[model samples]
Target: MKPLLSICCTSYNHENYIKETLDGFLMQKTNFPIEILIHDDASTDRSAEIIKEYAQKDGRIITILQTENQYSKKIKPWPNFLFPMAKGKYLALCEGDDYWIDPLKLQKQVDFLETHSDFNICFNASKIYIQDTNTFKEDPFRGKFPEILTIKDLARKNYIRTNTVVMRNNFTLPEWFNQLPFGDWPMYLIMIKDNKVKYIDDVMGVYRIHSEGVWSGKDKAKMIEMTLIGLDMLIKSNILPAHINKILLKRYRKYAFKAQKEKFRGYLKNR
Candidate 1:
């Protein structure tokens, strides 16, 4: 029988955390079949090696390695290039640095989606866990909310962790989606443009935050430019509400200012 869900994992240099992420997938207790497609983005570390090791033991695990780095200096169109490769009716996601804590996550989400025909995507709230300090942080976006959110709510900061989402592969993006300022934000927006997303307010996954992460780097000027550029793209696209665009613009400005201050302080201290 065909697998009901395809768990797509996109990883870079995450050797330290990839094991837990894979373990989470392997540990799932679903009655239906599932497949895991782990694509390593040409990491200099042992990440690819680790994935190969896991694939060796698990028949359902498949590993895709890039010949050269696809997204080191810049983002590459992952879903556009990778979605064609997915085999299941539903597409789920997991970052190598994050994992699912709930074994029934996939089962629950699949059941909900199969029953609720209106939902194009189904996701749950997650606990943002910082690795180094081993501390738990709350991502405000992950807070409890209504059973479903419209396209307007999806426009806000990505409330659903990448690992927590199970989307119907209805919309495919152009090559430019990978170039967007935020990967998940654009994808979420695209998914919800016509159909609303179902929310299961349970904490089903863990999102690891660390210093070397893509969003953890110390380059505020570049981030500010990227945010502005992204805002311009949204304005031109005309798919979201005007109020949502205005709110995001204000939030980006605040983030840019904070990033600028921190970056300048770091530079002065180093100098």
Candidate 2:
């Protein structure tokens, strides 16, 4: 049977959690065939060995082990380089560090997309687990949006979770997607601008927050810099006028600055 979905998982230094993540995929309660494309991005830890071990056991899992680390390269080669290799009509992504909490996640999303041909992508809400407390944070943006989201909605707030997003691979990813500050933000914006995105309104995945995590480790100043870059793109794309962009950018910039300063303070205290 042809696989109905292709899962693109990026793995790097996630040996401790890769097994759980793979287990989540294996537990999916779907009748349709599913295939996994696991990319081990030259992890220095035992993550590559773990992924290979699982692939050896599971026929549905396909593993890609890189000999060299790709993170130091100036250009980002994420789903962009991996998407073309996906064999399914729909792409369901689950990074090595993250795992699905609900086994029915794939089935539910697949059914929704298969039934609703008009919707290009669908995403559900997710639980944000902070490693410090090992507790899930309150996610206010966990609900369904209108059939189509505007650029303004995307600009005003980013509600989509990368772990929950299941998008149709019909359209070529926008060139700017790779350069955009946050990977998911650009991809969501591109889909919103070009196609109809639906919300599933369920928290079916857990996004682990740890010190080593890329998004979690980013300092406030760096985050603000990235946000500004995104703001500039939106303004240039004509999604927001100059005045609106300026006001919003200033508002977010302040928050970013505060965060940066606080992080610096923590560093100094530790030092």
Candidate 3:
């Protein structure tokens, strides 16, 4: 069956958590057909074997188990690989460390987008699972948000939860996207360039904040620095129009000031 949606996942040394992730994919209740794309980036762990086990059992699973690591060579798996190969009209993201709690997550998002032609994507609230604290808390921005969002609103910031995202599969990302330290922010920026996204007012998934998390585990200073770097790179790439660039530039300055304060706090602590 040609899938109407594709669940895109990337795994690396996630043997401990991959099974839960696979279960999350398996548990989705959708009216439309969906394909699962698991791109294992040559994990030295047993991640590949676990993926193989699942793929052998499910025909919907399409696994690409690489023998050599690509991320180490500055190659990202999604944009360069799994994304273009998606056979679905829409794509949903869920990292190997995260899982969906609401079985109707996909159905809800698809229903909204299928009815609304102007929107390119939709996402909902997700709980944050803090491993060190062993607590599941509401998303930081559980506060009210516009039912529809555009790049104009997002340019100032990106509070969108990646794991909750379900976006149109039509957009093409630049090759330079691989160079960005973070992919979701810029990728969504591109997706909503001339488009808008829907916000579903429901908690549907869990985003694990663990020490092993690729970015979530990073120190505050590093995460801020990466955000700044990605913004600057996007601005330099001139992908978005000049007006959008203006908004990004303002955001860039705000983060720069925050970065300076972080440095000062570090300096004070060392004294």
Which is the leading candidate under lDDT? 3
Across 57-151, the per-residue lDDT of candidate 1 in tens digits comes to: 99999888876887754655257445777888898988889999999999999999888878899998888888789999776775445678887
lDDT-better candidate, 1 vs 3: 3
Runs in model 1 with CA error above 4 Å? 73-77, 217-223, 239-271
lDDT of candidates 1 onward, in order: 0.80, 0.75, 0.89
For 1-271, candidate 2 gives per-residue lDDT tens digits of 7887988888889988888889988988997888988888789999999988888899998887888866555234455556877878888877787888888998888888888777777877788878778788856665535645655566567777777878787756656555666677666555554446777766788888887886766766676677767666655665544654665676567766776777788899999
Off by over 4 Å in 3: none
Task: Say what the RMSD of model 1 is.
Answer: 3.1
Top-down TM-score ranking: 3, 1, 2
In candidate 2, the residue pairs with backbone N, CA or C atoms under 3 Å apart (3 or more residues apart, or in different chains) clash, namely: none
Give the TM-score (vs. native) of candidate 1: 0.86
Which residue pairs does candidate 3 place in steric collision?
A: none
TM-score of each: 0.86, 0.82, 0.96
For candidate 2, the lDDT comes to 0.75
Over 1-271, each residue of candidate 3 has an lDDT whose tens digit, in order, gives 7999999999998998899889989999998999999999999999999999999999999998899999888788888889978999999998888888889999999998898889998999888899888898888787756878888888876778878999888889888888899898888888786878888989988888889888988999998899899999999999898999999999899989999999999999999
